[model samples]
Target: MLSTSEMTPETIEQEKLYLDLGLSEAEYVRVKQILQRRPNFTETGIFSVMWSEHCSYKTSKPLLKKFPSTAPHVLQGPGEGAGVVDIGDGMAVVFKIESHNHPSAVEPYQGAATGVGGIIRDVFSIGARPVALMNSLRFGNPGTGNVNHLFQEVVRGIAGYGNCVGIPTVGGEVQFDNSYEDNPLVNAMCVGLIRHEDMQKGIASGVGNTVMYAGAPTGRDGIHGATFASGDLTDDSDKDRPSVQVGDPFMEKLLIEACLEAIQSDALVGMQDMGAAGLTSSASEMASKAGTGMIMNLDLVPKREANMSAYELMLSESQERMLLVVEKGREQEIMDIFAKYGLEAAAVGEVTENTSFRLLQHGTTVADIPVDALAEEAPVYHMPSKEAAYVKAFQQMDERIPEVNDHADMLKQLLQQPTIASKEYVYDQYDSMVQTNTVVTPGSDAAVIRIKGTDKALAITTDCNSRYLHLDPETGGKTVVAEAARNIVCSGAQPLGLTDGLNYGNPTNPEVFWQMEKSVEGMSAAAKMLETPVISGNVSLYNQSNGKSIYPTPVVGMVGLASLEDITPSFFQETDDLVYVIGEAKPEFGGSELQKVVSGKYEGKAPGIDLQVEADRQQQLLRGIQAGLIQSAHDLSEGGLAIALAESVFTGKGLGVEVDLAGDATVALFSETQSRFLVTVRPEHKEDFETTVDNAVHIGLVTNNDTLLVRVNGTTKIEEDVSTLHQLWKGAIPCMLNRKA
Candidate 1:
């Protein structure tokens, strides 16, 4: 690893080749002309990076402007650090999902861990108490040793930070594929709770406002994160690992408490977390948004090392730091508060009268660029687009209908696929008990938490199965969206909004681009059907390595509204309740679990979508549960009806189920059908629930005996005690360890 001191002028020039730098002849002439009006290189780079499409909303900004972020229930949205939704009674919830794809691809563990740490700050920087943390991780298949190392390290990194910070890692999505072997995507989502009045913004106003640097001291780590993220990964990306910051969760925990306390004291006017673009980007953005100017003496910034260059000090993506525009006289008070936590704090600069960003290093001016020119005028380009040609893989008819001599043993084997098995091993590493606000934790379909002091609760979940998407982008995307919404609805919540992290391979490839286009269309259609607008999302492209790309993975993070009185957790409480399927299940075996279990081939087109059916079923189920007509609900996914039934039984108070599928044995058991839900309704309300839901089918009744008996076409396929079922489901993924090469 190269030290920061070794980064000479020649090294800086060498690094420039990896980024576009946006310094075209025409752009340079335009910038110079603007500089003729006023000149500053540091300010120019800050503005350029912040307003760049990667930082600024130049391209997507105009489009995102159309979203309904500020509804009647919205306490804050868009321009703020994170979106805040009013949860009634002066309480609100803040949530946002961000991508750190480029960095994580270079250095998986630290890159991912720091990504989590950064987003957590984004929440608490706004005076909110981060309640939960979730990550959507996409990587290349772990069949290869190196890929396995990256996967294990990334998981450990997320676990390490989340656990250390005392925030529960409630839920998330993980997928493996070839495209991501080299360039993985690590997108983290954080949700915070705060009082409506406590919410803060990233604006620096009032000429006398003092700008303070709080948290860890400046370092050379992640010097050009924004530019790094905006570039494509190549075989030489290992050399770019220095651009990924090393995380310090201990420092971050202290920072979170100190910042929240500082905001509570009414000493700070505005605040912003030092993420991606770090100091230069955060300060310039705060000033630009406030329509004011800022004058910074970089020399005053507390540093971990001596003799730092102006650029190094300005753009360093140092972890766990924040920029705060304090009310002049209260700077010392805030500094004292941070100091009590053993964290560093210093007054770096002041808000200025002129609308330009100014920097003085060692009392000498280095750069002074116009705020708007640098912050809002970065270039935006529309890339070339093309359609992907569909080519079906070679199919073997004989392997499709494998002889299952022992149906019970085959079901056990199928349950053991890593994708369908319990994620206890991973969830166990997380601190799911942190804030005492977690209403529903990891094992449930969706995690629910109370909105502090309010009668309302919020349900959240992230969902995606990339293997299905790689086989069929359109259907796979739609199914995942529906599944996420279904999970939330199963908890008796009305779906509110969505945040998507679209992870894909190199866009330069026509085939990958085609997958992306199709996936987006699928997601758009699903969102429309569900009436859930995507409020915030991220696009992660070029998730490829060594000339191979992973499957198209568009991870959907959804939030929904539920009153405390109506919350229905996924666990079944009564043994005698009737189990029902909310919608009809068809024999959609295109990309079914049956295909993976019967034949080792994992390629095939996913199931088709019936948007109307899905929407109607979801709506009916939500109404029934909210009306207290049902107690338990779970969505069908991964291993389909059989797995769904098994999971419901495994979590029930006592599981004895007798179900008869009115279809073919294999098709009725393991088909990857959509728009289906397994719900347990009271014996008396079972009839009413069926009537309420348009096409709900009463499959069986839960019994006192802890055994699961599934009869298909008069054949008893699975007969296992609840204890055995639980053991099998929980041990499924662990069993895959035996198959690991």
Candidate 2:
């Protein structure tokens, strides 16, 4: 272990553990020159860490300016704790996604729990009542003990916090592979509801305004968190576990109520949560956004432990904490409300007119930095682009045919695969019914929630299958976009806009660069076809561990517009409707589940894309549903048509059907044909539904008897009771979990 005396600048610099601060060679020299006039501790490691890329967005800040965050319907956007959009009728929706990659790699459970905790606070910080929560998690294969432990712990962590906080974990996606073994990516998103006029901004103004700290007391935990996030994890990260903050959902629960109540009383001017960078970031940003300054007295801060240093108080990422800017006279009211909840509230600072951030301890100045230079300015880089080599390689591949024996068993095994199985166990722990706005819950193509007053509702879904993208980026990317849009269409919604979280390996490598280029091009092409533009997004690089990188994962978070009248839930109704397969299923078995199960390999190419046809199909499906011609709809995705049919039956009241296919066995069962939807229509409207789409095919009808049968070329190829099929489908997940040992 290194001693305090030996923890000098040279040693720390050698570790490459300091924030870049977005400083140029000359600007850095200038900062050093200015620091020479300050005390020793003023130029210490904590200060530098707080000013780094993870905290300051030194690299991404410039590029984020190009996003269209604000629209006529947007109540609030960038610079706030979370973005708020006007959902109409005096109501607004607050939503945002944040990354917790480095910390999760260091300590999976606590890291993931705190990530959920932090994002919830972000939504509630702006006076919004958090209603829904979601996460997009990527990890290594679960067959390994360590990876399995991480996966289980991370899932439990999300459940523990979100469930306790009474916020429902509505929807999310999980991907497993070798690349994320050591460097897992855990991105959490939160959505909340608030009145449009009551939304709060985290800004500090007025020379006499009082600055207060509420919730938990400051501690040494999570020191230099921003710097820790920016650096690559190594074998020594086990020693840094203490740097990961601990979460307390009980305290967060109380804080949420207190903050929301305080905002309503007009006693608060600005508010922000002390996440990642803690007090330093919250206070500096609040003041900077208001074009003002602040002077924080470290000695006056409420601390959990005695004798805390000024730097520790500023940089600590202790959970359940928030900073507030209150008018001078209303400080007592704000303090009383927090005190009643048995929470600590202290006036540790005061807003200043001078445009500089000042820190004070024991009535003596510790550090002073210009607010404009430190808060608003961070470096942003437009990275160089390159052509992906895999694109051409996949385009040159020849399709190979796979021999099928007992296609029924093949379908059962594919549905049982961990990736394609039901995630009910995970979502059951979430409070998805909290706000009473959810129209359709988990285990669906997309989640639909009412917009409260209007006849309009919103449909949200997150999708991506990186394995396909890994095999063929362009097609994989296009499929993801197409599938997400199809999911919305299945719910009777028109695709609106998209937000992507691009997870990739080191971009400096040519192979990784190619993946990025192809994925983006594919996404762009699909987005144009769907008529949805990329709005807000995040890019996460360096997602590799143990010398291996994860597949190019560009998880798409899509939002669509839907009318309340035409909303179609994922589950089918009673047994009298006709079930139809709406698109052609071709015998293109590249990169398919049949290949994985039969061959134990992943070398085949992914499905191809026909943009025009997909777009037309989407529009036709929406028209059909809106006209009340289609009763229910579900998109065909993972595990192909067989799995889609299985899930549809499982969700319905009962399964009753016999599928008669006009195609080959493999093509009829396992082919993941895009733009295809399984729909249920009343026998009377069957003709209208058939004519709604140009290429619709009626394959079967719902039945009262609990049996599923498949007929291929006039032969009964597969038959099973509904209960047995359900057992097989549900058992797949637990079986895979038990196999981990």
Candidate 3:
């Protein structure tokens, strides 16, 4: 068969092949202008994947710049393999979050498994040992057979890879909604530990450094994966199954150990993971960062398939592979390190002073281009943006409070809504305590991991409420970031920084563009106010199935710092402890769990927040926790105060609460006002707690009695046994999945 190089520019246009490769006519013209001639087949393929939205961030880059990414402890922020932050005692924490949405939609098992594998590579490539893993998953109604199957496999895939790799899958969250019926979002996050002195970068410096290929062999699978991920899913998307990668965790385990060992050698200069655009991106970016060039003999790349073309070798998104730039004359030393791990390591190219990326196959020059053009010169567009009409309409609509005739029954049903229900069924499949560094497990506000030798620990969490963003993008954005920080604070930690996974719909649509723009603005303001700078992140656009788009879900993966002694529990500790509610609860039910259950859809304005108020309140609550005043602390979300109260009770020992709430019982229990918390204080420290946190309102008392009782307006509004509430809350998801189609 003739290669793409044999086709003339006229033939390429007649066949319209570039359009099939996710390139517009205007982009094709720009490529030709950059080259000063028509690009051959392999060169065209390189340009196509490098310029795709999945790799280039052409539309979102301008918006991303608005985020606050600097702080005193931030070692490295944005534009790297993973963000790094100093955690004291010469150690740093490295973390990042990325999405594998399109591939997961077509092939859930392999797609999710490779996503975990890929993110792990991102951490260790920078000389860090990944200690913990977290995920944020979004899917459709759990009762449907298709959605259940997808959810089951995605969880299994994550457990399979992470369990085998020996890193703990500590914590994460799962939300269900019909907007994600066809297109699901699977965002994976990896956090690693590193010594500042051992840190490495992904730069190919030194004119004569040898470029090495390590880990798995190259194959034809996942050839156009980058371009595939940049586009929307259609009914025919199943045809793109070849773009989904297969992963081997055992091989990755070997790679991780070997890379960590190799990083100790002074001969190693730079390293990068072969993710997204694969070899093309890894090579170009490494070279461009060093202001150097590279020349590769594609024939030297270890291939699993016979007679693979240059294009396939460059663009393959093969899992568990990495690119290394080593000093000349020390290639043998680096190769020997991988040999100890039974991995294929070979010298495939060399860094050059020529400043161009040149590729050769079978003694023939196949592709040659300026490295910066491929790495940094991709076209960026400020797509047209206009406020979504639905936002204004929803804002104008008055809030509708649901009439709860049976308060006890409504509490039971609200707890069963999959969005607010327990995720024990999902986390049970994961190995959360593998390394034994996990101090706090899956059921808390944030997962806490302790540094072995130091007294310090880290609190990590992933959060977002997409339904709120659907109602009001800007307010929802601020709410998500603040909520993430609140989770950390409740765990008795100081907010460090965050990594974001911005998952949105097609940005070409003006309304969708506006959502992205406004959401970034809100998140930026919150981050600045809370001092949780945006460190490293990824953006996944074009999350559309057919002509419909999912909610604008921007997931925040944040980490916080604390001492072991400062960590507080998320459940009640002692009987008769005084219970308090921090921050005022308002009749803000828009995009709330009650609204979803009653209306079966979302409407009305999203709950609003004052950034300064949230920041000040968090500081006060944290101080009380540090002073040993709090017996337990839980953030109010999803099902509102009632659900949070039930969770605090059910997840703990057989303890219950007797609460007397002011205002209408329905609004008091179910209104999801932002920046509120349900905390318990010891009886002896009650006065000190109230003094420390001036806004904390004494609302109830923890009791040995196994019943949750709520009184309002001198009348008993709700009273339920704790055992029944726990059963409904814990069994909702499993019960739905057990139903036969």
Top candidate, metric TM-score: 3
Ranking by TM-score: 3, 1, 2
Model 2 alpha-carbon miss at residue 715, Å: 4.0
Query: Where's the lowest-lDDT run of ten residues in candidate 2?
Result: 15-24
Pitting candidate 1 against candidate 3, the one with the higher TM-score is 3
**Which candidate's lDDT is highest?**
3
Off by over 4 Å in 2: 1-53, 56-72, 388-392, 435-437, 450-458, 472-475, 494-498, 507-539, 560-565, 586-591, 603-605, 610-615
7-99: candidate 1 lDDT, tens digit per residue: 443443445421244444455456657777422445445544665445764434433443345456666655667777766677877888888
Pitting candidate 2 against candidate 3, the one with the higher TM-score is 3
List model 3 lDDT by residue over 592-682, tens digit each. 9998888777899888899988998999999999998888899999988888889888854789899998888899899899989899998
Alpha-carbon local distance difference test for all models = 0.77, 0.76, 0.92
| lDDT for position 105 in model 1 | 71
Query: lDDT tens string, model 2, 510-551?
Result: 677667777877887887777765554566666665557778
Misplaced by over 4 Å in model 3 are 1-10
Runs of candidate 1 exceeding 4 Å displacement: 1-48, 51-53, 57-70, 391-410, 452-454, 471-475, 508-518, 599-605, 652-654, 721-725, 735-740
